[model samples]
Target: GKDKPTYNPKKERGDVVVVLNAAHVHLTHDKWNTKLYRWHTGYPGGLRSRTAREQWEADPTELIRNAVNGMLPKNKSREARLEKLKIFPESEHPFEGFPLVPFLPKPRLLQDRGLGWALPQHLALVRWCPPSLLLTPRGPGLGAAAQGFEPANPERYRFRLRTSPGLQGGAGRPVVGIEDLLTEEERRALAAAGQQGV
Candidate 1:
């Protein structure tokens, strides 16, 4: 973990060290083959193109440096800024002199966690329940118990209510249950309150 120097033209030039582990860098499917690096030799018909895989095979350090340079803002200072970028093919580097403080990887997507990734065991999976499903009459003496409302079950909360025979609603309107969708705990609570669920 190297410190990135602040860009200030007036102040003395500083160093920004960027260390990359080429072995661990993950690229999306087919990008290794499809992504191409092109450059010209400052002459007619001197264009050349090579896939990322080929470039990495040829020189991994240059490949990493080029990738990082491409992400930097294009300006007169771009070259100066790129000069500060130091890439290493592997984790080995001469950064032991500084107090290395490893940074936590900021995962932007599910795939960013790498293959077969998952949340920590201590973290609980939260299931969001719609307010309507948990709503109860708020009038005096009419709490959740009186309204026969309970926490929705993760398994059955999203399913459509079953239709009963000989019970039909308007042609366009659909008939749905109000309390029958409750889990066993909810039904037990309703039974305790002497209220029949739908």
Candidate 2:
């Protein structure tokens, strides 16, 4: 745990102190091989990594700390928490001399990047909002709901009414639904693509 700093909980307004046990951390699939842990000693390429397993052997606690951290919101508290964390290969930590308490990992659902934008109707909603694509009736409907309109499932909302009340009578045009959801997945795939931009 010497890899991290120790702090006092009694000093509520100051920095924090976290003691970690590296031996029992978990990591997703082959991230150990592909994940790169790079750093710099104010010199050239000081990048580093221990192939998950290697890191486990070197400092088991850091591996877990890093895995959990990557899932957190990138912000001030994120940085602070990392600063206070102290990883140890064994249960016996140097932080024992400080206000040491067991650190519990938060149980967070790993939302697929494709599904990150929930509220399926968000796109429809956005298009319907003050500005953007939904500005038009998305093939019909003028801020007015059709017969069985359910806001919860944008798929239930149909927009086949005529643009002009007396026009060709709302014809069937695509109103984005499950099929449209696929594009989100496609976006994620592209996002995960490599070196060259797709």
Candidate 3:
């Protein structure tokens, strides 16, 4: 009697990857004609070669398998890891009985051109702190207020700063007139210190 292999989730290190529509894989430029797959047939002058286009036409799954095999590390565990990969030329697959989770990429952040407030030369620093500690003080500001400081105002004080370019076109140079964390008294003191070259 042949023994059926049982799956143990705790023992497995990687997930079973199933790729469909292997035939429709796009090859950039002239790779379809230029790329060649060579193999030996274990006989005298048994070396054989096939173009990528010919290989895809004969067995599309093999094309994908070769690509994935090349990408994998050249180690002893490579064969075992490759066994988990299942490729289908078409959308049809036998793994419908098992749960399949589709892969989704994470959303990209908005670039400087996409954001109206963001500039090409300026670096934007956006920080979101708890409202209780800085904005709405039930008793007193435990952190900032305790140090004799508070945000200028709830509406104006948004923990966002834009840094401009410094001398020699270097980044991280702080620009003035956008201070949101200082009170009127603190601003006056800072202005007096600046005038006195402090």
lDDT of each: 0.47, 0.41, 0.53
Model 3 lDDT, residue 30, Cα: 51
RMSD of each: 21.1, 20.0, 21.6
lDDT of 2: 0.41
For candidate 1, give the lDDT of residue 71.
91
Q: After superposition, how far is residue 81 of candidate 2 from its true place, in Å?
A: 4.6
- Show the colliding residue pairs in model 3: none
Please identify model 1 stretches exceeding 4 Å from their true place.
Answer: 1-15, 107-198
Tens digit of per-residue lDDT, candidate 3, span 5-114: 65543343577898866765555435666789999999999999998878877887998899899997787767877899999876689999999865422222224555
**Quick one: RMSD of model 2?**
20.0
Better of 1 and 3 by lDDT: 3
Candidate 2: minimum summed lDDT over ten consecutive residues — where?
Answer: 128-137
What order do candidates take by TM-score, descending?
3, 1, 2
lDDT by residue for model 1 (63-124), tens: 67788788976777678777777677665788768774443222121122544444332111
Ranking by lDDT: 3, 1, 2
25-60: candidate 2 lDDT, tens digit per residue: 433334445566755677567655446556656666
Please give me the total number of clashing residue pairs in predicted model 1.
0
TM-score of 2: 0.33
